[model samples]
Target: MRDCNIIKDLLPLYKEDLLSNESKTFVEEHLKTCPECENLLNEEIEIESKNTKPLDFVERRIKKETRYFTLAVLALIGSILIFIISYLNTPRHIEYDKDLYKVYRNDKIYTVEFADKVSGIDYTDTEDAIYLDAYSTKYDEIFNKRRLRKSLTFRKENLKTVLYQNHESMPNMVIGSGEIHQTLLPRLFLGFYARLSIIGFIGLTLILFLIEKFRKKAISLPIKTLLIGAPLSLFLGIIAIKGFNTATYYPVTDFKYIVLLSLGIYLFFIFISIFKEQKRM
Candidate 1:
């Protein structure tokens, strides 16, 4: 007589559709001759049917979780967009010539003058020095005076040195006397506007980063940020550096270019991080 116990062990595999064809046939034949084994096989098959309902329920729950996670990522992206728009729209004061003379008299400053525009400070014995030639016709005449000495003076006790400067590279024209002219280079603001521009660019970049974090999609966020941020940052940085030259009254140089290039390199790394994260997903 075929053992009922032996058939019971194979019954579970048979119900799950896991039994080999030969094994299935052998078990079925054994069950037919033994009423006890037949009863056991029928019971095992019923249990398997009951188990499938729970497996289906679990799969449905997992799919719902994934959907909700995606929705949350999208909401985060929306918030980032709102923040960026608001930040860009806000007004930021551009301080051009506050404490103008301090920058003009310091020997450590570098100066540049523009050929087409005359920019200078008028020192009255009473009130603070006034920016006389600003955005005016008087600036044109003052700026075009080629006969005027175009150099900066450095004084060390009884010793003095004059650095020959080119007008093409100068930030703006000035109508100061020999003393003022001598002090101009060292006291001039070298990269004031450029610095401010860099700050603002960084602020914008931060906004981009925040948006990417919220979206969590990682598809093209990093590369996109770099594509958009790099050129934009460079353009704004140049404008800022120029403004610094215009305000502090100087010209662009190798040093300023170096700073801008460095910023670009740093941004490249930030984009790489975003790329890696996206790949991980």
Candidate 2:
């Protein structure tokens, strides 16, 4: 234990206050005669002090950084939540049924029958409104017949009783006639958002997938795949659900849009994962 080599081996532990009493006394006794070993101990102490000071500084910097990062994350989350709420609650401009009726009664009505191939004014609504089948046709000189029937249904109530003479097209297009339907407005809005959400999601996923495949060996992802994926998935999912709720009137279109949107979101996550992995590398 009084050996100089033993004291050198224990120098690091001694500085750390981990030396046994016997080792401590042995090193102290040798240090009395060995100026070289004493100088070595002093040097070790200075190095340890410098190293510990930097570590403390680094630990404080990390703590400060973590605090700021947490605040930023919270603020971002709050903003997104507000945006979503505002979007969901925003009142949409929609044409009501009463407005449609008013427009119908004031506009000119043209009734065309498919079977009789006749356009007549006698196509008035009876006690039970007459249902008209209107179709478009193209004339073929070779066959001496009109071809290509694109038919649409119309209720007699949809017709406007008065006739208006105009040279330009109507300001608004009609679904069945020149009147607008209220039910379609919400559906259209929902369809638009659903399409946007779906596209964004898909783009994100594709990017992630490519990154993952190309940079698999290069880098580690900064965050776990699920950490980023879950949040993004939730965001897109909420958007799709909101769209579906609004588009309830048009279930088929809404459902189709939702499916597309979900797929797109999934792809986006894949891309995100890949990009993160690349960055880490």
* TM accuracy, model 1: 0.30
User: Tens digit of lDDT per residue, candidate 1, span 1-59?
Assistant: 44566677888787777999999898878877888877777776687678755687677
Error of 2 at 101 (Å): 20
Give the lDDT of residue 246 in candidate 2.
50
| Residue 148 miss distance in model 2 (angstroms) | 59
* Alpha-carbon runs more than 4 Å astray in model 2: 1-37, 53-68, 71-73, 76-187, 217-245, 248-281
Which model scores highest in lDDT? 2
lDDT of 2: 0.46
How high is each candidate's TM-score? 0.30, 0.34
lDDT of each: 0.45, 0.46
Please estimate how well model 1 matches the true structure, expressed as its whole-model Cα lDDT: 0.45
lDDT of 2 by residue, 169-246 (tens): 222332244452221112345556556655765676677777778988532343344434544554465464553445
Q: RMSD of each candidate? A: 17.3, 17.8
